[model samples]
Target: MDHLLPLSRVAKLVGTSRHALQEMIRSGTLDTFDGMVELNELLRAFPDTKWEDDAEFRRITEIKERAFGKRVFERALPDKEVLAARLFELGNEYAATKALLMHYSQVLSWLDEKIDEIEEDQNKETRHALHVLRAFIVRHLAEIPPDAAKVQALIAQERILKIMSAHVTIKPSGHEFIVESNDTLLEAALRAGVSLDYGCSNGNCGDCRARLISGEVRKVRAHDYVLSQAEKDSGVILLCSCAAVNDVVIEANVAGASDIHQQQLVVKVKAVEVFNPQVAALHLLAPRSQRLRYLAGQSVRLSAHGASGRYAIASCPCEERHIEIQVLRNADDAFSQLLFSGLNANENIELEGPYGEFVLEDASTRPIIFVAFGVGFAPVKSLIQHAMSLDLAESIDLHWLADEAGYYQNNLCRAWADALDNFTYITHASTTEVETTLANIVNDYPDLHRFDVYAAGTAAQLQLAKRVFLKHGLPAQQWRAGATDA
Candidate 1:
């Protein structure tokens, strides 16, 4: 080796300890292929000595725009005094412009509210814009101040209008149902009175995806961050995301959601103990005065100032008042940092919802097959716990899959593993044994059919499991898969 300094040397040069350097490498902040700093990336990550160990802090400030750039215009509607007369007298051009502006105003108001909740130093400027936008929305119509910055933006909007005004035809659904305003198809086909599927008005969960059979749409606010480019390209747009560019034809299958009450809860962390090196069991207790009830498989979004993330409730619905969530520490993940960096314990955090519709149906004893992968074991753990408590039929089978023995709390998982007589733990550790355990088990057991399967995990793992289940003659309709693109 010509001159390779050890990690210790680099740490000393950067005025930090060896342990900090190791943490950085483990979390990918400092890259080292063979004990040598990929000097360029390392320097870029820690441009100053102050950020040597505080890598996340530096990274967050440097990358705020990409993460929190989704701000909406919250300004009030335009003055009716000047434009109302002109707008009323106008034909197609007036109607289109007015509708577009109204959409912008609504989106901006919503965007500002969301931005207000985010606390980051780098987001101050964006937050300021949100404040201004909020004021405009409350006023209903305020002049967009003429500024050098808005000239180009206004030009772009005019171009968009030109593109959108192109004439197109909308195919009628030919039904009698309420036309959901958010659904561009149903909105366009209003004369036909066809319905659209919608669950929560919140776009955080995706349920309103539909095919744009033809024609185009100019989004109201680009609030459809839940959509992937692939989904967009495949003609799938959330009724929540589309505003008709031109009249368009669409296939409509609307699913109605039951009324759900939303609540704000304050949960105190009761325990944060390591289940395994990578997995942790977190117990949170709601305020004694607050009575919050959630279904077995629903998830809650947890928020601490400057941070927010969704975690599936891991405890049974019939369990004690306290809620339990299992968290896997991904060293590079921001939420994981809070968990491991002594920020998760004994802290009071805000929680929203008991969201998602993945719970088991009642009155019908549909055989359930639970397939959990990695940290996805959390929700299955809850559903199983609920089923056991309710004394539901032993007709349920849970298949818990992981890559290694030490991936999660073996003892906690084992506790459930041992107590539930109906449940079978399928431990797959490809890291150790040479055999293809997963494929082999499916191959050997031909009796896997006749049960409904619910699979949750990373997209690839879940997809693989689905393929395997289908290959073994499992009915596609009986299987439910949950995968988050994030």
Candidate 2:
């Protein structure tokens, strides 16, 4: 079911060479060489095999056939060998993404089957432990380092598998094939000698959105985010939430246009001003000797003691001396409590950033609508300020929304409006004044078709707005979102 088993593994198990595995696929004996046996075929060939009634295996096989147009026979799962062969055969051939996802679902289902089998084994403690460890190792092979000595040590002490053979094939992209243990997709691309474009590794930043051109991946953690069902249907994936389930080929350019390097600055908290009862505005001064460079609307990572969190830089890129961030107390958040109450003004907080791709585009002559929810206003504030500083003559609508008006600071928008000539600020108190969604407001607008919208906030609100935009026939590329969890 899991498509990414090491080829070396299948080679050892079936006594077939990796080349022969590929040859098998080429010669039509196997659909893939990914170290998977067709479920039905395996059952028929070996009636005494243990997996005949395995639900996971059956589920995987069914899903694979239904989703990817691939027939699963004898064990019904293709390991890495089969996957690689298929990728090679389908090189750049267009296939339905939905079909591919179905295949992935099937693979995961099969893995679940294997896990169940191992868990059900009534064996010695050591054997059971080994089984569990092997399952983990097989499922997470991409995360293991290729070091021989370290792997040997793990095999000896942890009862891990000694080796899995894989054909180390690299495409003509001349992309360095770098594998990582516990590395972000962006980090892996970099190590693999690819210039993968990424805004933030934190899921909160949506800079690394792309499609999984091929292969399977596992979804893991995410920040509070939002995306349209249509986007998901279209194969758009967030690299932040994706981990390799197999050798994957994603439709993302490493050297994309958005790649940027910002100068790092270790700054000290010079002052903390409570902008409102709920929101605290933090100002940092470049440590007596260092300065950080970042564009407006970029974000940063902050660490206090040992815990760290991500926040958007509210200051303009030109401001080298002072950096500012507006944070609202999340009474439910441990990090927020520490920042607002426990941290001192002079305390040294670790900072890293000026990373984010939510900036205004160059050819964006269309009117702009900015929608912000809660503290999601941080990046929006920066973009607005930067637009004014650059003196870009553009018509922009700032639609700021919150559950309660009093909980939000109105002065920030008021100041920006007073300073700028073309900016229009509209506030919605979702609690009492306007409980309607932003998409409703966009729909009510006179010239919705003339504006390019950027939305950031709750997943529900963004989804509503996305549907409205798409319903009105806005181009998918024109409506950009910040981050999406769901």
Candidate 3:
């Protein structure tokens, strides 16, 4: 004869909420017998529920069959309510079973909202009692069956091994990468050539910072970077020090098209025009069949003979065959001297890359604020021209800071401001004036967080500007910075 249990008893037996079981009954998804549900019917309705000791139960039945009992234990499955009552009776002596009973009681109290109604002192007492009971159970369980416990522990270890070998999926791009148990997320990403932003992979810098969107990860090693309390609470982890404990999804600033594999080519210099005594614009032309593919605001390594330098591509990507770079001559630098004096038209130069992540984010529709210092304007010019070509509707404000001699292309910038309805230009000649200008800009647009800020300058200048912008309520995610090559 099948024994029937109440809905609440079924909920307790299955470790599910009573409300869920009630919904099944109300929706006609489950049939009740005399205000109760049969254990078989509940299992049929919730097929995914895990029943403890199922394998042991089957083994016991087989043993009985092999022993002179013809399927004696076949119909021995007890009613959930009766089983639960009998387990509580046994729990008075078995510490492990007692701990399970306490856990279920606390869960039921929480579900009934009774925990919230309890006094803080009573709650603390209950929690402390539960903790002590759990410890006692753990200590006692170790003495029950050493060999069986060892086998169960090995089974748990195998389950954990499977979880640790799971793959990680990067969001927005849906890129999948496997994470070894011993490897950090950044190490796995680098091995797979995933092109994530990173610097000083030892975690001294926060460049490899990413948010854990879903799943679990743990810090596998200590990190030098100091994260704020809010960052920790928000699930931000340094990829260089974090390893996935299970399949995980992370949100990070992934590399786009410009970050793909770089190509090496030898190109001919078409022209080298000296804008002033200190600055020159060098134009180069790649072979018609092998034009360079790159995004605006990316820099390339240019080498001729023994001199090599990293210079930003000042021209827009639309001019594929023609590459323009602005070089600031330095008295002590070999590459600068070579470009200023030793370079000539039609000279062969080796070009290596189109690197850097300073390009404009097309996904943003917010207004833009660009601040450039000295030769840092090179990439800014390329970005602005590209934005103009795209006919982006957002307003653009450009702040150029340099000595009088460095603003050789001031007229061109003014021309852009005059031609484009959405563009605005401002120039500052002194460091103090630049600081004042940036402060005034922030004051003028009290909501600085609504704009995307791009800054290019010396490392010191970029750092100072980032601090100021962040203080003025601009989010770190809304700002990009590029350090000018010395």
Q: Judged by lDDT, which candidate is best?
A: 3
Query: Model 1 scores what on Cα lDDT?
Result: 0.55
* Model 2: lowest-lDDT 10 consecutive positions: 158-167
Per-residue lDDT over 1-486 for candidate 3, one digit per residue giving the tens place of the 0 to 100 score: 464654434543454434456557778999899757875576568666445334543453254234311112232333333234334534553687578889977776574454334434476778676667656755764576634443354334333333335466777765555554366787666433354666556777787799999977777667889999999899999988887765578998666655556878889999998899988989899875455656778889998879888888888654536789988888766788998885788989999987888887755657898888888898998887656533332688998878545688887787677655568998877655556666766776688888999888888888878888888999999999887763
Model 2 regions more than 4 Å off: 1-257, 262-265, 404-407, 432-435, 484-486
Which numbered prediction scores highest in TM-score against the true structure? 3
Which regions of candidate 1 deviate over 4 angstroms? 1-259, 364-366, 404-407, 431-437, 484-486
Worst 10 residues of 3 by lDDT: 68-77
Taking all chains together, the TM-score of candidate 1 against the true structure is 0.44
Worst 10 residues of 1 by lDDT: 65-74
* Candidate ranking (TM-score, best to worst): 3, 2, 1
412 in model 1: Cα distance from truth in Å?
3.5
**lDDT (tens digit, per residue) of candidate 2 on 1-486:** 422334433333333334454455557655533444443332233334232233444454354334211111223233444345435544433255467878987887787677667667556885678677767856775465544443343223211121111122223332323222334454345322244455545565566677766665555455445666887788777765665544565677544225566555567888887766677778887763345545556677777777666777766543435778877677665556777785677778778865667666633446677877766687777666545432322567888777532436576577556544457888776653233555567666666666778777656767767887767767677786654211
RMSD of 1: 28.2
Cα RMSD of predicted structure 3: 24.1
TM-score of 2: 0.44
